[model samples]
Target: MDHLLGEVRAAGGVARVASLRARGHSRRTIENAVSSRALTRPRNGWVAMPGADPLLVAAARAGVVLTCHTQARRLGLWVLEERPVHVAAPPHRHVGEVKRDTHVHWARPLVPRHPDALVDPIENVLVIAAACLPREEALTIWEAALRLELVERWSFERMPLPSSARDVLAECSSHSDSGLETLIPVRLRFLRLPIRQQVWLAGHPVDFLIGDRLVLQIDGGHHVGAQRRSDIAHDARLTLMGFHVIRIDYVQVVTRWPEVHDVIVRAIAQGLHRAA
Candidate 1:
């Protein structure tokens, strides 16, 4: 039993006790380890010790595609909400089989699917999670996803998402975050903003371009620590390159959109006047 526990810890500190039992570990031995604090039971049949990420252990025990906000965070995709475990299984699968603490979604399979599609990629899971998140949070996750290239524009367009998803996508179109950055083009159209969604100027990708004069930046707060310093340096460089830059926080784009609109309009006017 100690040998089994040692092996589990070496392999990332989590293992299914049931799997161990199947492999011939005695039930009494497993229970003894649990009682001795060598293993901590997070869910039925699953245990983790000091070395494993509990979330990963939980996901492994469920035996389905771990998804939504949970998977998004795991894959380093930007996530706006901290949800409990979100797992997606086939429609035919019984939800009762899942542990009580998990939030399970039985979804229709995504189409044109490859073998890899059985598991929700970080991008698809985030799109689903974003649909459930607050509009602002969804936008941040979207922008971050785009910057990271986790999702592509065409892939988002092609998804057979529900109406609820479409509504979220429309809201996310104008918002920016790594979570759903792929939807920026769609969002800009919804807002009727006559600006390029992503344009390269002065060697950095600017979020929105209102002609050659004005550049709009969508600042995702998570990146703020390092990004704030980078933004300061980039703004100085843009000033030298003869482009007027206007920056907006993720909150402003979702909550105070009118203010963001007004700021952009004023900046564009100033930029045009200066150019002339």
Candidate 2:
């Protein structure tokens, strides 16, 4: 009985009764555990340990996997925005009924899903995300996945990904330090400047180096306390070395992008991006 509960805990606080049975637990053992209140049924044939994640329990109840942007954010990838919880229904199967606000992805997975799995793997998440999010927003998540080494690059090359997804994956660079690093260069590409990312200068990496002399630093949430001081010191050092520095925060890069864009344009017009 303890072993039965252990099985459920090892499976992320949830397990299918069939899966438990396959693991050598008999139906009577499962029933006894449930009868003793050691396990719970979120839905038919599914058992969850006490204090299971509500979202996973809900997914089990609905016979779906948490996927797309939801899973991407779960995996710590940078998501452009939050939306309704996204889930993927099993292929060719009805989900019966779910909340009307739940965004369901019905496309076949690029990777096969395990019957007992409650979350989509990174590959499936990326594929579904590509189909769901706008091109650039999806690219940010893809690049972050690569940068964090969540998914192997070889997977992208070999997976039978749709052309749209393939195109976005092709643009992904593992060197991007964050989603902002990915977003900055791609958005600035229209200027036809030689833009480089994660460039080493003054013994640290600048988020971006444009043309020959301009350094762009993007300050995410982590850029506070000691980190903020370090960045400010770096900006001063870059100035001493005859490089132009433009540092922007998360809100500036995301919400007030047009104003940030104008500043960069003005700096370029002054040849700040050029070596003197």
Best by TM-score: 2
Least accurate 10 contiguous residues by lDDT in model 1:
109-118
Candidate 1, residues 46-147: lDDT per residue as tens digits?
677755775555555565667777776766766654667778777786533566777877766453223222247655575566656666556666656665
Off by more than 4 A, model 2: 222-227
Every candidate's lDDT: 0.64, 0.89
Give a tens-digit lDDT track for model 2, residues 1-276: 999999999999989999999989999999998899999988989999889988789889999999989989888889988899999976688884667899999988888899999999889899888888987789999988887888889967987889888988888877787777778877898999999888899999988899999988888899899999998998999999999999999899888999999999999999999999
Count clashes in each candidate, considering only residues at least 3 apart in sequence or on different chains.
17, 0
Worst 10 residues of 2 by lDDT: 89-98
Among these predicted structures, which one has the highest lDDT? 2
lDDT of 2 at 25: 100
